[model samples]
Target: MTETVLAEVLAELAELDDPKARAVNERHGDDHGVNLGKLRAVAKRLKTQQDLAVQLWQTDDTAARLLALLVCRPRAYDRGDLDLMLRQARAPKVHDWLVNYVVKKSPHAEELRRAWFADPDPVVASAGWALTTERVAKKAAGLDLVGLLDVIEAGMATAPDRLQWAMNHCLAQIGIEHPEHRTRAIAIGERLGVLRDYPTQPGCTSPFAPIWITEMVARQGAAVGRANASPGR
Candidate 1:
């Protein structure tokens, strides 16, 4: 049954191939040659099909791996399985999607984060930081915010590119969500000068932590104001 499902999935992907889209993806370092829109559509149809997802992932096609990230049951795999998958993730796009979509949603995310953070493998370490950034942005109730800030301040300068991006995001989330640390986060951003002068396209917010934090904080304040100004309030 898994083989049959894998065959069907591959057939669908083959039919959905787009040369133009594939070209764009290749330009952006995605050598998959498969259309992402079609992959998402396939994932929606195959949701929660863990056996098929594993089979597709074993095929090692980029689109199939992305589908695996979407459809695989997070609870079915433990840290060992995730570590193996991360080790096999050679493509940047595949590694990123696995981190965001698979690892972040897993029940063992925090456990994996602790282990992966210290991993010498850059991909594993990047995934750890990415998961931490998500937790900081969303549910930071029990996290040691000060310790986290200290780690980011100490390591972000020498971190690899992928890990550095997520670390910067974590710093911004601290400033945006934790008012007590906002001043310190901004100070760290200023000291590091990360993306401080990086050119941004028209209308896009800068990724520089200070600017990112300022915009997020203002946006949050405006949201609160709107909620308070509402008639029901």
Candidate 2:
């Protein structure tokens, strides 16, 4: 059944392959060339097929692995399984999906995040920080906001690029969600120059920590004001 599923997925992927999309993926460091739209479509078709997902992942094809992320059972993945996936993931895009779509949704997310944070491998550490950002964004009640800020302040400047990106996001989330931390987060952003010069697309908020925090805070305030002005608020 897994082989049959894999064959169908590969056939669909081949039929949907676009040279332009493959080139773009390659340029972005995804060597296992595949069009993203087709990959997602394949995943949609194979959704919830855990055994097939594992088989696809073992193939190590970029598109297949992405499909695996969509179909694989997160509850079935233990720390060892996640570790193996992270080690096998060489592309930043792949790592991002694995963390956000797979590990973050797993029961072992917190356990893996704590362990991965201390890992020497940058990819693993990046995943840890990514999970941390999700936790902070959702306002997880037990997170030590001050300790998180301290870590960001102490290591952000010297962190690897991917880890730094996630750390900066965590800092921004803190400023956005916790009004009291807004000023400090902005100060940290200024000190570290996090994504200071990143080129943002038109009509999009800058991802620079200071700008992002300020924008998010303003948006939140506007939302609150709207809520208060409503008839039943």
Candidate 3:
């Protein structure tokens, strides 16, 4: 089944220059065109197939490689194929690809979460941001909230001003996602220190607000925690 999917993808890749193919590709390429129309067609045909994913994984073009990464769902992941994609995904856009798809979709949440912590690229770092935002909010029992927190800790420990700014943005995102656990974020603010904390910098786009601003988060979470601690209310 995988091989058959691969064959079809290869066939498409081979005929990329054919007028019929060009027309189809053009239709897909136009930003003004509806993506659903194209996506539906692709999905229906590729529902059970997996080869189109493989060819794109193997493609030499950085854009094509990133596109393939974006197209494949996290659930469809073949570890070997993902390993290859990560290895070949040297371009910045590829990291962005992982950020938007794997992190945001987060189908295989845990493995991809680990990747965000380990990957050094800014784009991959953004995945860490997404995970922090998505998981910390729910406070899922099995998800490694502590491990994700460690990424922020490491970022604060080593970050220079520029990198610190970006890392802080990620921390802020975590806070927004988990307003229920603002105390967990206090460490992030404390570690980040006085430099442009997110709380004080009202206009700043960075998500990592100063710990003080987390007052709202703290208040909300505290109320919930207190309520939960109480008997039946």
Candidate 4:
């Protein structure tokens, strides 16, 4: 990939909550790699900010180094290379980006999510969150709701809290996307007892209150009834 523009880099940096880390990534992101160094120079001169660049040059945080790899030119890193980088880096921002960006788009999304589940590191856990949100939402059409529920059920058996958050995010998105699958989701929720732990919200009174699957099931049932009542009767 060609060097990203200073403006684009700045926009992405802004998403980061930490100003210093964002500034460092923006200013020195291009300086480390051979091919990317030229791009960084151009961005540096264009922005006229050398202090942050110099500081980035001196710091030795593995997170910074890992962020530089993704920001400077992600295409250059082989899939296998990310493992080595992850081993050395533990910054939350970098971990979130890897979860949100790299793993979501990689072929190993499932494995990455599983790793995040297995690892105790918050950064990795957050990446697991990202993997579940982005990948599942994007591929909702192709997923088998029954199979997915089974997987999530199995995951919840091993790690309920972590996978529960992930399931909630994914299921909510899926409910929105495939309104027809609400019944199946409600069944899954019942099987997993998601509603038991997180009781339905009181005021909404929607079937899917504490759990969205309830609302989805109600809607789907209505639709199915309508379909059944339609022609031949």
Best by lDDT: 1
Clash counts for the predictions, in order:
0, 0, 8, 4
Tens digit of lDDT per residue, candidate 4, span 141-216?
A: 5546666656555664345443455565565555555657655555555666554655445665333322565555
- Per residue, candidate 1 scores C-alpha lDDT tens digits across 1-233 of 77887898888887777888889888776766776776788788777888987898899888778888888887788888888998888778888888878888778889988888778877678888878888888888888899999999999988887788878888998998889999999999999998898789998889999999999889889999999999977
Give me candidate 1's TM-score against the actual structure.
0.91
lDDT of each: 0.85, 0.84, 0.54, 0.50
| TM-score of model 4 (CA atoms) | 0.46
Report the C-alpha displacement of residue 193, candidate 3, in angstroms.
5.6
Distance from true location, Cα of 52 in model 1, Å:
0.7
Question: Comparing candidate 1 with candidate 3, which one achieves the higher TM-score?
Answer: 1
State how far residue 199 of model 3 sits from its true place (Å).
Answer: 16
Clashing pairs in 2: none
Better of 3 and 4 by TM-score: 3
TM-score of each: 0.91, 0.93, 0.49, 0.46
Candidates sorted by TM-score, best first: 2, 1, 3, 4
Model 1 worst lDDT window (10 residues): 29-38
- lDDT winner between candidates 1 and 2: 1
| RMSD in angstroms between candidate 4 and the native structure over all alpha carbons | 10.6
Task: Residues 32-134, candidate 2: write the lDDT tens digits.
Answer: 5576666777677656888887887898887778878888888888889998899899887788889988888888988998888778887788888888888
